[model samples]
Target: MRMAARPLAWLLLLGILLVTVLPIEWRPVTGEPANLERLVAFALVGFVFVVGYPRHWWLVLGLVIAVALGFELAQLLAPSRHATLKDAVVKVAGGSLGVTAGVAANFLFTRLVPR
Candidate 1:
């Protein structure tokens, strides 16, 4: 799983970028609130990144945050999309939570697992 983590994390990040900059009509609706979707999506991305690159957890956190801010700004490139500070905050909050969880999980795994 560790060996596959980096690639999977990168793939997920790419998907996030593509979805963020696409036309609103092209975005999928899961019946969930828009902010909720953003929160969960970014959370998952952050979690996967940390899990895949445990040794570079700090770098992962920073990169995830940068992505959150950058992606929110990217919405400006899409005429149909609007960028807002509120949305960016929510995404950053979610990613932070995920990265925290990932770090805790990594710590426990290293301490308890027969590595």
Candidate 2:
């Protein structure tokens, strides 16, 4: 897990990028509903990113924020997507929570593990 974490983290981030730009009908509806998917998706991105680069978690945080911004902006040109400030805010907020969670988890794990 340690060795693969880095590449897996990048792949996860890339996957988000790919999914965002491509045309898809993947809006969060049903069950959890209303912005739930944003939380989960960004959270996963944050978790993998921090776990992969705990030594530079701040970089991961910045990268996630960049991802959020880039995706929202790219939506302006997407064929079926419409860009909106509201969506961008929700995405950034969700990404923020995710990054924080990742940082906290990494801190706790590192403290508990024998160095």
Candidate 3:
């Protein structure tokens, strides 16, 4: 069961990466805050990793940070996308929050369900 779950988890992770790397224009709809989308994205990614690999949450977090930094740096190559220290900070904050939430969720899940 664990082995089968691993592949599905990996596919989910890859999908997350694709979504993260894809560039999208920021246009806030009415009643929606500007940064809301990004925050959700970060949180979702962190949560996914945490749930998928609870034993290696730190490693997953580290990799997410590294990927975010790399993506930020890559933005410099595009004339439309300039890298910002603020964005990097936001990414780290979002990722961290997500990881924390995921950990908490995992704890709750384990407490509720026994192996």
Best of the two (1, 2) by lDDT: 1
Candidates ranked, most accurate by TM-score first: 1, 2, 3
Best by lDDT: 1
| Model 3: residue 16 alpha-carbon error in angstroms | 6.3
| lDDT per residue as tens, model 2, 1-115 | 5567789877877776776777767643456754677667787777777777778778888888888888889987888776677767777787778778878988888899888
Per-residue accuracy of model 3 over 14-56 as CA lDDT, tens digit each: 6545444455454224466635655666767777777878888
Q: For each candidate, what is the lDDT?
A: 0.90, 0.76, 0.69
RMSD after Cα superposition, model 2: 2.3
TM-score of each: 0.96, 0.82, 0.74
Q: Residue 45 of model 2: what lDDT?
A: 79
| Residue-level lDDT tens digits of model 1 in 1-115 | 7778789989989998988999989898899999999899888888888999998888988998999999999999899999999999998988888888889999999999995
Instruction: Give candidate 2's error at residue 20 in angstroms.
Output: 1.7
RMSD to the true structure for each prediction, in A, is 0.8, 2.3, 3.7
Candidate 1 achieves a global lDDT of 0.90
**TM-score-better candidate, 1 vs 2:** 1
